[model samples]
Target: MINDSGTLAQSHLLIVDDSLDELRILKSLLDAHHFRLSVAFDGLQGYQRAQTLRPDLILMDVRMPKADGFSACRLLKANPQTRDIPVVFLSAAASPEERLTGLSIGGVDYVTKPFLAEEVLARVRIHLQLASRHMDTQEGAAEALDPDEVLLQAGIALIRSRLGETLTVDEIATRVGSYGKKLSAVFRERTGLTVFAFLREERLKTGRRWLADTDTSIQDVADQLCFQNAGNFATAFRERFGLTPTAYRKSVRAGRLIEA
Candidate 1:
């Protein structure tokens, strides 16, 4: 979908987050874009306004005091009245796994924190235009897939939510009441990955974040991501990003930018 010059004048946006600093940063950028704005500091209040106002777009924070962004998104997607509204997640949780989780649960876009203003504006404008077209489609015409696809998505979501634990595909299959081998096949078909491969990638992504964004010890980062030991974690981290965890952290702290 495309928009002309006056497209943004009629739009409304809802932003939900617990951090005043983050909200202010977004508001400063978005206010210049000239859309109507409403703010909520927690997920519950955010959801209430979503239901009442039915805004053109929503910008949600992943971590909040009340119901988190994922849960709130599920509610919006499941509701008939609000199901077509677009949601964009704003968070520091930047990783392939986190992005997948947000999209699977119905976010239209994901914006990583400390984000560039131009990128945020571009994404918000694109999703808003996309949602405008989506709402114009006839009811019940969105893509339809098997319930099994949903199950695989849910299993992955569980994995992302429990990154701190020693999770196995077998345990997840049991929890979701599916056989291990069948679930693995479903995962491969849907995501081009076996469950273990995806799990390892997600763990590495988490380890990288902790190294740069927190003052976590190498051993502690390994423990948090459920790596077997610090040695193994260092080996895997270096292989993935071509730097030891400590070097990566130091480079980031020194303002020499590197993508995680």
Candidate 2:
């Protein structure tokens, strides 16, 4: 729900287009609305920016040099981190087919070029509200989301649910009704991490949490997380977090944790 101060102040918007004039106008309008903004000159840059910045919404132009807006949208939707972000396409093309293509590929709305300033603002606000509501109730909307997105979510859930197990990428893929090669490709495309890498990171994270919150010995922690022994666990932990498990636990207890 929008607060009394207005939700626009907390909103971040990404504008992707090739035209400098269009960007300038859109930037000015959104800035006046008190929305934080980021700009990308081409579709490729826009996709990269969205992945990193995670803006609340995107205003994408249909045509560009490196990658067109439609292609970029496809990549964004495939990525789990950026898929939920609302995309509003801004195109010079007024044809029904173009707008339909944008919506069919996961865009939330379309705004034709030479758009009215007020209309753009209204649409942006409306979609942002809708996106915010969806985020608040995402669990209920999970079944309606894109299948690839649902697949990625389910795969991550499986990994977390079995963090202590010595599971392989092939096993995870099969359990999720996919093959190793295909799942790995999707994981890389959607999360920028291979399944194996993600599993390793999750294991380390669980170890860190146990160290900070539990009195479990390092050896037991290692054993539970499926490491061969404490020595192997300590080595991997230090390499990942720049401290031995003992040191990390001590620092947390002392309430003077050093940067890792």
Q: Supply candidate 1's per-residue lDDT for 227.
A: 87
Put down candidate 2 lDDT per residue, 1-260, tens digits, no spaces: 35556565568899999999999999999888788889999887998898779899999998887667876777677566788999999999779988997897789999998899999999999998888778877764322445467557657866886788889888876655456897798899999999998888889999999999899999999999989999999999999999999989999999976655
Least well predicted 10-residue stretch by lDDT in candidate 2:
139-148
Q: Residues 19-136, candidate 1: write the lDDT tens digits.
A: 9999888888888878778998876688668878889899999877656777567656645566678999999878898789889778888988888999988898888877777666
Computed on alpha carbons, the lDDT of every model, listed in order, comes to 0.80, 0.84
Give the winner by TM-score.
2
TM-scores of the candidates are: 0.53, 0.54
